[model samples]
Target chain A: MRSSAADRTRPTPLDGLVVLAVLAAAAAIFYFFRPVSGNFLTARIVLDNELVAELPLSDLTEPVTLEVPGVRYPITVEGENGRVRVLHSDCPSQDCVHTGWVSRSGGQIVCLPNRLVITVTGGAAEADAVTG
Target chain B: MTHSVRRLTRCAVLTALALAISVCEGLVPLSVLIPLPGLRLGLANLVTVYALCRLSGRDALGILVSRCLLGAVVGGNLTALAFSLSGGLLALGTMWLLLRVPGLSLFGVCIAGAAAHNTGQILAAMGVLASPAIAIYLAPLLAASVLTGAVTGAASILLVRRVPFDEGKP
Candidate 1:
């Protein structure tokens, strides 16, 4: 069998389409599930359904320490004018730190070891804070 | 019976190669490039791609199944089995899909397969944790997937060039 250019290879347009489709689906999922509010100051830390910590992060200057059973993580709040983030953590995975800054609605930092989560709600903090 | 035996032997050799690469990757600490956790070279995927193109789908699946089971035993990380399972299935499935295209090279197919594998693994993590937030990390994982996919795919391409897949009858 004589090998020819056709036998060797060609560009796969369908493969590119597949990659684009997956990317689009991912973006759609992200957009659909995106939090409604755009305010980053409504960040809250919750364990189970009870509110552990709530911050209006517009004036976040101090680092906060959140401790659960067998785990202690310090959430360092930095940045000014509503662009704050959890700078550091003591978790084994360090996933929370890699989560970068949470400025958008529906963004959160979770430490599975302690079953702890820091959520950034897009909406303004209600006068009466509701626990989820 | 002779044909079956030859296929099994080939599968066994490929499995050994995959396992060796996986073990070698595990032994070394590779945090210098980026500090992202659960990062691996996934060199084993070269064998998976080779089997998918040269052998039957069943043969490719067999390689993956055997590799996953024995790989977990040797690596001693049952937790990793979940990620590998999801990733392998997705990777193989994508490769099979691309195989339908008449002129697609094994290298392109493998690259596509690797990307799908990473996506599947990340999705599995999110599902297991009941946290959709993990989706945010997909960008970095996709970037890594492209790089590793190209490296492994190119290597697999060169390998197929050297060892033609037309010899064995499955």
Candidate 2:
């Protein structure tokens, strides 16, 4: 009986409108910002804001593996067939290892624990900042 | 109980309850359920949601802040304070604003707040990790937040309606 009078506390008609607005915004951002796949073959590895290694995926006759000394443990980076991934890492979060793979331009596999970032691209584009 | 004392006690209880929920959430591997990155049920948020709907914004903000801090300390993960603090404040700010709009309720307020929470976390992460590439996670995280927001919003509405603690308050 108490809630019956407090309709303001319940779902309103505008709920649909707001939900649709945010979902539409999410879809637009996802679609427009989606990464581009194919042809961009350089996998640049950066550690601690410094450029570390640049592997040309297109020129690889075989899968190339890099064993980088991370902050606490060694990290393995693998690249081949225009794709790159963190093959292994002992970082507590394992966020970098779980990143799986990157085969597209603007795609990145970052290991924050190791201050490592790997970006694949045909030409390097400066990272763009987005404000909330 | 005097009104001020009662309100203060209620805020403290809400803070403890919210902190416990948040700590438990951190231990649970929710990935098994949602199989998505950066997605959580955000159950603790329901406490703040209920607070805002029933109590004044001041109490709600107090609960949110103390809960995040205690939740981090209890979880023994101070690194989390950055993300949770940013997300919690933004979520509270969004919810507080949305609650004032005519015809809007917990559902819509929480949905927008959840999105804002994710945005705040990403923004903080970009600062912490010093990498703009982290922005790639924003879209996916926001998309995942909608589902979480809906679930939390439902729980929040139930809490707000069933609590019946502050029926006489404005």
Candidate 3:
């Protein structure tokens, strides 16, 4: 007598428990390494994978446009109310524009085609990568 | 139909369905719906799960590879082909291994596969970007994988139960 594939694949209670345990463990790890809020308040800009400028969000009184060498368009960096953002860019994907603002450490605005990245430093945000 | 011919036809039909789902998924703006980059419902995995449960591992592997190739071409992102291929293969391989566990259900297997897919993609991203910082995404990606994996697994279970497929001897 042979068992059908359906029977072989039937899930037992233990299977559910195991999956639940794995998920819980993942959540725990996320919570443990979660970004912490701190006083680090500078946005570091990198162009062509090189550190170009570091703007202190605390001292920003008005919006400033940054021009990168060899890039046709400039990136408008604005700081307001303890937050920073890329107000404008000439990149095709507009990913930088879509990034909106970075107020916490670990927040980043990456323009892949332009090879530009803006990341907040000296805060509790410690995430080094973004995933979907 | 003769057993050999019937097997071939089944594999073709499953491959076509998988490809269609993959392409259709590309058309939908899953990012808008989920508000996350590189995240999708992974609806195409439904077909893979179904194949794994009902068909031979070889047949499922064929369908998975074909679907990934055709999907990447049709979607017009050749650069993404590497990521998709690595992720899909990792997921399929994980599910295959987990299925051998006696008490493990399809749901758990699928969830594991989903998680593996994310890991594989992240690894690929690290290589492409030439940066190891991408590892920080592991926790979030795992969390997301749990959700997406559960949804896909549940759907696959429903499909396997509801749809009648001839379970011939392997």
Candidate 4:
């Protein structure tokens, strides 16, 4: 009798355990790396590894649009109360535009083609709670 | 000498198959729905899993490398080669190590491989973009890996069961 590949055992208990462990670890990482919710959030716009603008969202009396310097494609960005997002971009991918809004600390919207990165960093409020 | 030649031929075919699957997967507008950077079903890994189970780890690694290189060209840029290589190597390494464990199934190995692959891509992205803050994106990515890995694992298991590589014959 010739043997076929079906002889392998069904999913063992160990496989289920491994899957659970992977999921748990992922959840824990998501929790650990989660953006902190603070009273004040600052949106930092970086272009090609340089800081182009930093908007203090808390103190922002009105929403502002940013002008990125020396970018190959035109990208429109808007920042308002504790959040920021790309409104539009001439870049073909539209990856940054699709990122929508980022309001929490450590959140980011990246445009790889244009090398534009918008990140939200919260200050003071959640630091002690998050770290300690 | 003939045996080595036969093995090389098999691995080359395997690499081509993997490349084809990856190319087909890319054709789907999955990115439009998910809108997540670098997320995919990772169907190409099925070939790697099948090769690893039936063939040697060396063969699997060879296929993975060649497929990534070719896939990058098919992708229309060299920058993608970095992501594919980083992810493919790490995913293959994780699956290879896991195969040594007792009583583990394709499910565990493939799922773990997927997670490692995503992590490797993010690490490469951080390096290329010089942005550490993007690390937060790993969370959803890791979660997505489990689902994608499960799909890949289940499909490979079927391939392993049904497809006869005809290893031994009278």
Cα RMSD for candidates in order: 7.4, 8.4, 7.7, 8.2
Q: How much lDDT does each candidate structure score?
A: 0.66, 0.77, 0.73, 0.80
Model 4 agreement with the true structure over B19-68: per-residue lDDT tens digits:
98888888895677887888899988898888888887889999999998
Q: Please report how far candidate 3 places residue A89 from its true position, in Å.
A: 17
Scoring each candidate complex against the real one, what DockQ results?
0.15, 0.26, 0.21, 0.26
- Cα lDDT of candidate 3 equals 0.73
* Stretches of candidate 2 exceeding 4 Å from the true structure: A1-10, A43-55, A58-62, A65-120, A123-132, B167-170
Which digits, one per residue and each the tens of the lDDT, describe model 3 over residues A24-119?
756875666555455546777888877777776655566655555565466676665456788888878887887776776677888887888888
Pairs in clash, predicted candidate 3: A36-A124, A40-A122
lDDT of 4 at A34: 72
lDDT of 1 by residue, A1-132 (tens): 212211344435654564565556556655665535444466677766567666665444554433333335544533334444657666678777766666655667776655667776655544234222
User: Docking quality tier of candidate 2?
Assistant: acceptable
Pitting candidate 1 against candidate 4, the one with the higher lDDT is: 4
Candidate number with the higher DockQ (1 or 2): 2
Question: How do the predictions measure up, each by TM-score?
Answer: 0.68, 0.72, 0.66, 0.73
Error of 2 at B5 (Å): 1.8
Candidate with the larger TM-score of 1 and 4 = 4
lDDT of 1 by residue, B1-170 (tens): 98878888989998888888778877874545777555556678888777766666788888888888898898788878888889888988887777776556655576677778878888789877766667766655555665666677677766655665556345
Off by over 4 Å in 4: A1-9, A42-56, A59-62, A65-79, A83-132
Model 3 CA lDDT for position A2: 16
- Residue pair clashes in candidate 1: A37-A122
- Identify the CAPRI category of the predicted complex in candidate 1: incorrect
